[model samples]
Target: MSESTKRWGLLRHHDFRQLIVAESISHLGSQITILALPLVAVAVLHAPPFQVALLMTFQYLAFLVVGLPAGALVDRMRRRRVLVAADLGRAVLLGSIPLAWALDWLSMPQLYVVVLLSGVLTVFFDVAYQSYLPHLVREEDLVEGNAKLEAVQNVAMIGGPAVGGLLVRLVGAPIAVLLDALSFLGSALFVGRIRSVEQAAPRPERTRIGQEIMQGLRFVLANPVLRAIALSTAWLNFFSAILESMILLLLARTLGLSAGVIGLLLSLIGLGALAGALSARRVTDRFGQRRMIWVSIVVTAPFGLLLPFAREGWLLWAAMIGWAVTYFGGTVYNIAQVSLRQALTPPNLLGRMNATMRFMVWGTLPLGSLVGGVLGQYLGVRPAMLVGAIGYLFGFVPVVLSPLRRTAPAPVGEVADDLPGSEQPVRK
Candidate 1:
């Protein structure tokens, strides 16, 4: 290898360094919003359980609304531009929240609108950002690149919540959102500075939007590995959303925990994620890629049963442990599956493949939140959480039954050609 090439590990890779900076900034901002947004709903707006669920629903609803079309559109444009635009758009939307609060013009309906708009922009940014990574690094370095990004991202995750909680305690929830808005602007600046020249790959014939969307879906369904990932993750996310939707309120209302303590508990998940990010490559290397995907969830998800057992006294330890364990497993599983997906997909199809899988996995989150809110209202929070744990326990079935259980990792270029219907997309 050339000396220059050897030195350009993701740290030295200019374009990738910028991408990492952008993502790291964005992740921190997102973590802050995660805590602050819910606080706003619960404390300021006095939204009910179902209404809180509606807020969460608005935050992710874009995936269901425009996911497929966004994927098709991303494939036809320069990815970096899409990312920049999304970041700037989110900045404006989130910035509006603080402005509205200062003017005493903030309302629940306005918050919902802002959240929904932010989600739509996020959908666009994520589709473009995930698709653009491979172009920044060598094919073999994809895993390392992803891990590096996640590592710092976990750091931001760890700190952002703690800071956000303190800010909410001191200043207020609406004011805390301004930090997120500023961070988005920073992310946009970093992303816009990347010098990589992104151009749409030339095609012999352009297909209709519906066909392009279908092509992406077919590719995922036809590939056993991708199909397994989509199904297992979809189920896991569904149940996870159920449990997570109530955690903040559970801590605050039922347990009467302060925002600082609640944030500390949430940061434990970030701590676990950081550990998982650091060890993902090593763990996957030792266990083999596909095996770890299902194994991680099977082993970790059972801890979720402990969550509902948590109560005010020492029992709160049970919830914290469960949160940490489940998060660790999730982080490891994500690193393995995401790297595998990026490696296995053809570069031309990366955007669509990621979008399709996201639609499958994340589309269920809002539904899960809604169901969780209903269960929390009707059955009580702990019982609802218990039910979610049961779902997680069985969520591994789809992947366990598929061929991925026995598969091993392989290079990206070698993997895609053998998948069924891969050749047909180019022809159409």
Candidate 2:
């Protein structure tokens, strides 16, 4: 393969192709749910703002509840089995929604139960998914692999919402969820087809699960770069949750926008994210990965301030522009940081490291959702979203001030033991 072909050569691997196909189907399904689930709560159930927001809280609360132990467990099992089981579980859980609705038995409580249980399954899938990649592809291909997957996610983001809007408009939100459930089944089938063999997890050798979890925690905390990335990402997710939890309510109720229009507006974030994912490799090549991490956020996050000013007219377009820009930057930052994380950790620690990071970064989402719900309940949705947009402006501070700014990208297939304050050495 020529250098250019090799740079994008992951597609040549049959297993990698299967992985992306699985992810593509799953991402599209997920994007549909992202719009449909909340709409189900708002439109069908006539849920109040706080209750609508609580849906998000229930969805992400699993990360905090099972995040650490999930990592240890993933490391001890076949990641592919974990992925398939999670996918099947989510399918069954989501499939119940349409069934309940059909039987005229759907309730807010059922929605909450479905979301919460589905989230637990998602937690396991996500940790195993990240940990499974290195086993599937070479170290040098990490960035490319992550970028392609991220791109697939963004593409789904662009199309799924538009499709979801049409589906919701035609069939109502409850039936729309059925597609997502089916997609999970499709994802499971594709994943099952991947032929690469995952070695059996080594025996635990008497190490307790708690100690394993703490070991992952210590590795992340002790490393300056990982620590800063985790902090900044957590901060970003906190505010993002607040913004996202309220956006649908604001557009649907406050601005009086239709579902179709809202879906189009939401797709703008995907447009921006797609652009970022496409450009990440070249951009990182020109600007060092370390510099790009902070630079991306610093340049694009400020646009989020425009979101608070959105109204029914031209101002809404301006707000969407801000939203798109913010997602663009966020996608770039994500690719860079995730690749770095994958490269830095030893293979055995991948599950725990990813879990610990998820625990730190995603744990705040529930809190943010709760806060957004409260703020929207008391202060109104627009004002609550304004607070979130403002918070985005400062999310870059941790990465900006960290040793990561002064560090270079770690060479492929090797750890940077010389990194300042590096405590846990990567096990070869």
Candidate 3:
């Protein structure tokens, strides 16, 4: 390997590369599924706009309500097992859709139920997966490791929307979801094959279960950095949710855009995300992670508002492009934040910490989804979207208002071991 190439984490370790490949393929499936699911509700099921948004809201609910408990479970159990179970469970749940559809037994309500259930499992899989990264690679490698994953996801996000549109045009929406299910199984199989050494753990679960759960919440809430991020994420998600389903609806109904144009625009934005993820490490070092996170949130957030201004042809595409830039910014911001959080957290509490933050930030999603529909119903599409854009501006308020804005990266093994309820950072 070339010296410069070796300096970055491209081909150094087999485990990291395996993770990237597995996650990349899985993300493509995930993105495709997410994109296709909404299209299914709209085109095939003939559901109203509100019902379609409900599908997305149901999926996000797991992160908000169940994230903490799932995290606690992950801390006590094997992370790899959690990932495997989550993957297999999601595969079965998702696969049921096509099966039921083929049997002529599929219904809108059933699709909603499937989405919700699969989302619940994903909450466990995601929290455990993030925590497990520290065990897979060194602290210095965290940003690089996460960057690769983020880059792929960004690529998928771009492609997923476009791919969904085409698949709907070609094979029908129900079948598109199958692609995602298989990807999960693919991820499960690859993860099962990794034979690398895991960090060792001591005896599990001496502390009371309730206490353990609370400890994770306490650490995330009390930590300034995590708290700031949680606040930022919650606001961002809530506002984004507000406009979530409304975008495609507006494009189709109000602006008179073709489905192909919408898909293409979505895919084009991914190019920005790929760029952001590729350069995240250098950017993080230059600006410092904390400031960058807030700056990115604040600056990029207004993209949602631009959507309302979309008129025709160039104008509509312009708005989507604006959103893509911000989406890319948000992607890099998250990579920075995850790396920082993992670096600071003790191994034992990593899962819990991840879950606690996820729950709080993600929990508000349903309300946001509901509000969007109601606003669109009473006020109109553009106004409702404007409100969503305004709300997203709140993401940076907590960060700008806090002392965490200037903090440097915390060293590894500083997992607050001195605290009474602290457990050592759990290893595989």
Highest TM-score against the true fold, candidate:
2
Candidates ranked, most accurate by lDDT first: 2, 1, 3
The sequence of per-residue lDDT tens digits that candidate 3 reaches over residues 29-59 is 8877866777777777777777876887788
lDDT, candidate 3, equals: 0.78
Instruction: Give the alpha carbon lDDT tens digit for every residue of 321-426 in model 1.
Output: 7777888888888988998898888877888898999899989988998899999989898888888888988887898898877665444445556533344232
Off by over 4 Å in 3: 1-4, 7-10, 203-205, 256-258, 407-415, 418-428
> Model 3, 276: alpha-carbon shift in Å?
1.7
Task: Compare the candidates by lDDT and give the number of the best one.
Answer: 2
- With a 3 Å backbone cut-off (N, CA, C), the pairs that clash in candidate 2 are none
lDDT of 1: 0.84
lDDT of each: 0.84, 0.90, 0.78
